[model samples]
Target: MTAPLLEPPGGRPLRIGSRTSLLATVQARHVAELIHEYAPGVATEIVPIRVSADVWDGDLSRIGGKGAFSKEIDRALVAGEIDVAVHCMKDVPGDVPLAEGTAFGAYLERGDVHDVVVTRDGTPLADLPPGSVVGTGSVRRRAQLGMYRPDLRTERIRGNVDSRLARLNEDGSGYAALILARVGLDRIGETAQPQEVLPLEFHQADEGVVSMVPAVGAGVIGVQARQRDLAVMSLLGGLNHDQTARHILAERSMLHELRGHCNSPIAGYATTTADGAMSLHGMVFNRDGSELVRFHCSGSPDDPAALGSEVAAELLRLGARRLIDATGG
Candidate 1:
């Protein structure tokens, strides 16, 4: 028989696994708050787990790529160290499967789903001069920047959001602009910086200058727990935002169908209409943005995964896989 959802448990507070970074801690704390709100008196603790991506101090692609960030937390979950784990959904890989007995149980409400361009002096993308160095580690961003302004050179950047912004805010011969996630900025409360935050739809140099289809599950926080953990699952299920989960699942399914890595230069976004239909926009680009493929599909929100897979299939039929492979993502 299943245990009651709110049967006063033992003295141990439910432990939550999360990364140690400031932004990660903030997200984890938010989840903890939600759990407390949903089940008053259900104690919870935050457990910080170190990850390979945080310690590799080198190229992630050459190491383990996106999985490096969440693998440790997942391990904690599998090892019985943490009752639940919070994740920046984008860090969860599409190609790498999850550990046995573990799965995402809920998705917190979504946040801003667009990447913002931050410039040293709030200069619009078009105003930037040729040969300007833009710092970013994302292949998609690099390719999109090339597509917009081929003359601007790109330098690989790796660090937490704050560190990246600090480097750009400092006076140096470093990047003139940095491409960062707007959601992250808001979470960290660093939106008041002197840099300009350009809208995803902002046009300057050319049509679709900075395409922002968004990474799959970009602004969502996922709560993960052992599938059979009835108590944890029940508690988190109360916090799940059905609409956000549907959108993320659709995006994730589209990514999975392409056999693309989570860190691949692929971008996809899904939105639900008032009438309960889901529409997905997906894009695939070669390493240099020399080639581009874009597609869209709509379906009932009740079957987001199917809609996502269908869109991905259409994209692949049009040679999306070829473009994805060329990037080595």
Candidate 2:
């Protein structure tokens, strides 16, 4: 038998907090829909909040690192301005602890985890002219690109997907291509063609085939609420996707163990099998992709964190710390 749905305090509509960006609002609405499905009669409201990362035109590291994206929303959550907060797991910094008094109540099912390339004319990455410039904000992506195409140069590009696409379309924009997460583009209704999807392995002229590892928590959405709020937690718990949650746990565990920061060129992906086993792949790279260390391992799904830590330990032993510290991450 299903349990009775707990009503919000005072019978008010449950308010969901999200960033002001169109993508953020869309994601928040998705969460609201999930809530509605879980409790047919429950009422929900979306609250758009502006975050520091959105307003700051300068480098994100200058403000408060990656937390700039979530701090304000977290503050609202802690202050009772909203009942729940939605976040893209990839944007959540792995090195730092989450906001005090708050914890993630659920992680939505994972989405397409592959990164895709968007070019002006749908050109394959390898066919691009030598010295052509690619734009991306991720150190991990930049480093991987360096490893893949030493002749190609990378410029830092920041903004939401639309703005980035606009930059790519601008007359003077030097970007020959922009690499983005496939899921983000799909969510925003900008699906990439099959040829544009970057393969997991690419042929590097001299180095043979190289693999592009995805960032930790790349394709997951996390729902957060105050830890002590039983009603909210109970409500949000129903939305958790067990397999996705396990993968996030393993990936995040590896990230936490590595002490990776926004500047850290770290990538990790975790997967679970139907047999209750899990595998994690972790990699760390230098700023320019001149150095890299990677490790992979399998373990019991019951202890995802342990598996993540094991991979992290292996990476550290292989001199991942030196590469991470060199970038001052």
For candidate 2, the per-residue lDDT at 13 reads 93
Using alpha carbons, what is the TM-score of model 2?
0.95
lDDT of 1 at 300: 91
Q: Provide C-alpha RMSD values for all models, in order.
A: 2.6, 1.8
Worst 10 residues of 1 by lDDT: 1-10
lDDT of 2 by residue, 65-122 (tens): 8899999999999899998999999999998888899999999999988888888788
Q: Name model 2 segments beyond 4 Å from true.
A: 1-4, 192-195, 201-210, 274-276
User: RMSD in Å for candidate 1, one decimal?
Assistant: 2.6
Number of backbone collisions per candidate: 0, 0
Tens digits of per-residue lDDT for model 1 on 97-164? 88899888899999987788887678877788899998987777887777778989998887789888
- Overall lDDT per candidate, in order of appearance: 0.82, 0.86
